[model samples]
Target chain A: MKHYREPSIEAAETGKPSRKGLVFLAGLTLLFSSCRLDMHDQPKYESYEASEFFADGQASRIPPEGTIPQGGLRQGELLYTGKMDGGDSELFPFPITQDTLVRGQDRYNIYCSPCHDKVGTGRGIIVRRGMKQPPSFHIARLREAPPGYFFDVMTNGFGAMFSYSSRVQPRDRWAIAAYIRALQLSQNASYGDVSEEDLEKLEEAATE
Target chain B: MAQLFHPNINILIRILVGVVVVLAAGLGLAYYQGYYSVYFSQVNVFREQPVMFSHKHHVNGLGIDCRYCHTSVEVSSSAGIPPTHTCMGCHSQVWTEAPILEPVRESYRTGTPLQWVRVHDLPDFVYFNHSIHVKKGVGCTTCHGQVDQMPLMMQVNTLFMGWCLECHRNPEDYVRPREEVFSVSWVPPSNQKELGRRLVEEYQIKSRTNCSSCHR
Candidate 1:
């Protein structure tokens, strides 16, 4: 056949590849470029993204009034509000079990330890870092303050401290109050505060 | 024609061309590789903050917990920065006259915030929840690296999509006990892979690879 010949000298000088290489490269490029990016800029409304469907033109719909949210029902005054007859109450809504105390400790370390400190000394790491040092729980005034008073401060903002109702639930707030009471008791404890059996253990440890 | 006949000269030309090609290829590969390497990708780039607060000093030296300064870590998406009062609580007593603390004092006096530059910044599109991660048994060190060791905060991980996917697809490899979430020096136990799997089941963590999980 007339055209069945080796590549010409001109082809070598031009540096043209054989037909197979060009076709292969074209196929590879097409394969890569064909991937659909439809998922990236999706037709979706983000949280609070404005919408035309709602009359307010806001995507986030406000819950209807009198709507008791799931797990949002606050039936008891002492449990939720920390108040009875518009004043702080002394009694706990739930029994203060050892498990409750442990939960209180965990919650306290996470939330209150920054400001009130591990010992409720008002000299937490944040206080050392530079925030206003609150009154120590060991102070006679705070030591005598009822548990509900602390709960009031947490539920409703007290002075410079903001309300922790958002971060802490009502039950957890009571737990924190209980823990704070324990802390106050710890720092202000006298020999009379210890039981006879615990006193013996303490004496033994001291003698050792 | 005479120049072409010189065999040594021809050999020298070939060797020079070969060296150029090898050098070019080496440089190109290095440019590609180094661009993505953890060492070079802003890994140790320390941004200057308004206050020269050192995590090394506050965390390691003073034994401060990560939550002390980043207060809202357990409740909010962003770990809240400590307010100006938090700084003055100590400076009001200790470093009252130190010139290094001038800006902090000024912010306190003005009732204005010291605008601390964020170091570990994520893109606007990505939705990362600190509370979910922290509550799900991911420790502070798991994502933030050894921040107590960092004198000035710097981005350590690349925080690229692949890096995120690597963990998201296999959370059992990294999950720890909830109690150890705050422990900066916490090491995975000898039976970690086994424990982690149990934790994955207990925590009910479905390591989702769907785009909407993080993107939305």
Candidate 2:
């Protein structure tokens, strides 16, 4: 049988020290495992106040007062009363001009063509797909409507139509109304007095 | 003694793991609860006007148009609120004894415009035009509910993006002619779809359904 011997003092001391070291290491590992760095999370930029954004103060140019031309009818007032007050002629002046018609056409394409169609036939895609269909500018009643009436409708909103008062400026709306009148005339133009030169140009265009 | 020593080491390790788990769980519970409680929620807390001055009353009731009070609504970007003197135009001679008129009187005397609370307010990001709506024959009631009936006006409708879109999607269904625009008695035609179609054809009306029409 092997002789029984007491454990070495050095070994016993080192054994205890090693055990404590192991325990400390375990504790440290647990602590470290619990902490995490969130590298993916980032800070976002915040929106600034209006004053800060427009620091130059140039953004606050208040428009001059009394800019709207006078003699225009106000809201709730009738457009035109069929009276021969000489004002009636001024209200719906005859002989629509080429430049006026062109301006009107430009305005119509921008504001009206999207829904009313370029020809003012109300066949715009918005209408074709069962959307709200606007009346043709070529219609008799609308064709006869006074400029003031168009101006009023554009200023206020008619049925289903909300007001453009906030969308189109007053002067621009007036321009658009003038354009609508021009559209009506173009659709209703008579071929009775066509010049030979005009007719020849039309024929040449058609042939092309 | 040897058995006891190894078990003690194991027990220490177990306790260390348990403490870390508990700490993590506690932190997670706190974080989730705070997140669900709307940690970043903020309320708009600005003071606004109090009385609901009727654009309808001044426009329709007395036949005073929008320009009469909001003098620059047409020409300018802002359809400005009328000054105290605008109220004193008629109130000084008309309803001098009324209780509500007291504020109007005080504002005039003090040279301060009555801080009449604005009700139909939109977000600053939105670009709304009073002139365009007015020009289009859009009744004031479309956005601002029936003001003639209200003494002190409350916001009648939610001026939300969705609410505006609802009308925009089908404008002619709600549109009335120029003559009936201001009249409270005005009613949408029975055949709204047909009427819309007719208006689009006859009046050369434009569609407001597009995003750029209102948003841009």
lDDT of 1 by residue, B1-113 (tens): 36646667888899999999998899768766875775546777887887788899877877767865676888778777777766664566656888989999998898656
Q: Pick the candidate with the highest TM-score.
A: 1
* After superposition, candidate 1 runs with Cα above 4 Å error: A1-88, A91-100, A111-141, A152-172, A184-208, B1-24, B37-40, B89-94
Worst 10 residues of 1 chain A by lDDT: A33-42
* Model 2, runs deviating above 4 Å: A1-208, B1-67, B71-78, B97-99
lDDT of 1 by residue, A150-204 (tens): 8999888676676777667889899988988888778878999999999999999
Isolated chain A TM-score, each model: 0.70, 0.53
Residue A33, model 2: lDDT of 46
True contacts kept of each: 0.06, 0.00
Candidate 2, residue B170: CA error in Å? 1.6
Pick out the ten consecutive residues of candidate 1 chain B with the lowest summed lDDT: B86-95
TM-score of each: 0.64, 0.40
